[model samples]
Target: MKKSIEEIQKEIISEFSDLTDWEEKFQYLIELGEELPAYPEEKRTESYLVPGCQSRVWVCPSLENGELQFYADSDTALTKGLIAILIRVFSGHSPKEIANASLEFIDAIGLSKFLSISRRNGLSSMVNMLQNFAKNSGSEI
Candidate 1:
């Protein structure tokens, strides 16, 4: 069976547990960003750009078999990794799953406290966008 969102969050928290230093955590985030699939150039447009971010970020969602799949990219590596984390948690899940998720892992992983105010805002924006996509399931976002 596929992992639940909470399971994924636990895994992420576990992954971050070993990296006690902020520098290490930031490096890990960059590495996570490196793992993201290359985003399509054509989809890099104003409509897909996520607002409230210090760096330019774009997230595209598609509904397939009732699951929401997300593709994203960001101008900065850190932001890219942030999006990657969100994608990992939200993608490949039903709209209701993504919409109802509490995403407490962010706080558990200490990411919320470590991020700058702007970065935190950006992260919040990304979460809002993902939930918005879920809320507007099957409709164009």
Candidate 2:
């Protein structure tokens, strides 16, 4: 069975809790970025780029069999990992769930405290972009 968002969040929190410092978290994020699949050059166009982000961000959300899926990429490595993190949390969720998700869960995971201000802003923008896509696609989120 597919994992629920709560389960995924718990798993992520457990995984990250091993590190005691922000630098280690940053390094872990970078490592996660290294594992992200590269976005095709053809897909890296103005249409996909998310506004309000410091780095070039491309987000695509689609519905398959009533489930939401997200494809995202970013020019910055750390940002890409951020996208990956979002994907882990939001993908396969209902639009309403994604839209209603509180940042508190992220904070609970300790990611918010460790991130730089710019990175936090970027994360907010990324979430906005995903929510926008869901709204446009006729999902409640």
Candidate 3:
């Protein structure tokens, strides 16, 4: 069975808990970014661009077997890492699950505190976009 969003978040929090410093955490994020699947050039158009982000970010959502799968990428390494984290938690879940997700891991891991105000806003934008896609999809869980 697929893990719930909260379950996945807890696992991520546990993973971050091991890192002693922000530098180490940042390195971890870069490694996570490196794990993101290769994004298609065709999907990297204006339509997929996430608004309000400091860096260029694109996310494409597809519904398969009653779940929403997200494909995302960003121009900056840090931003790419951030998006990768979001995708790991949100993808392969029902729209209802995603729409209702609290995403407490962001705070629990001290990610928001480390990011710049602009980057924080960008993160917020990314979360909003994900939820909006879920809300708009009208798919049953």
Whose TM-score is greatest here?
A: 3
| Full candidate order by TM-score, most accurate first | 3, 1, 2
Candidate lDDT scores, in order, read 0.93, 0.79, 0.94
Query: For candidate 2, what is the TM-score?
Result: 0.87
RMSD of each: 2.0, 1.9, 1.0
TM-score against truth, every candidate: 0.96, 0.87, 0.97
Model 3's alpha-carbon lDDT is 0.94
What lDDT does candidate 1 reach at residue 120? 96
What tens digits encode model 2's per-residue C-alpha lDDT throughout 91-125?
Answer: 89887777776655578767677777887888888
Candidate 3 deviates by what RMSD?
1.0
How many pairs collide in each candidate, listed in order? 0, 1, 0
Q: Write the per-residue lDDT of candidate 1 for residues 1-141, one digit (tens) a residue.
A: 999999999999999999979899899999999999999999999999998888999999999998999999999999999999999999999998898899999999888899999999999999999999899895432
Which residue pairs come into collision in candidate 3?
none
TM-score of 3: 0.97
Top lDDT: which candidate number?
3
Error of 1 at 82 (Å): 0.4
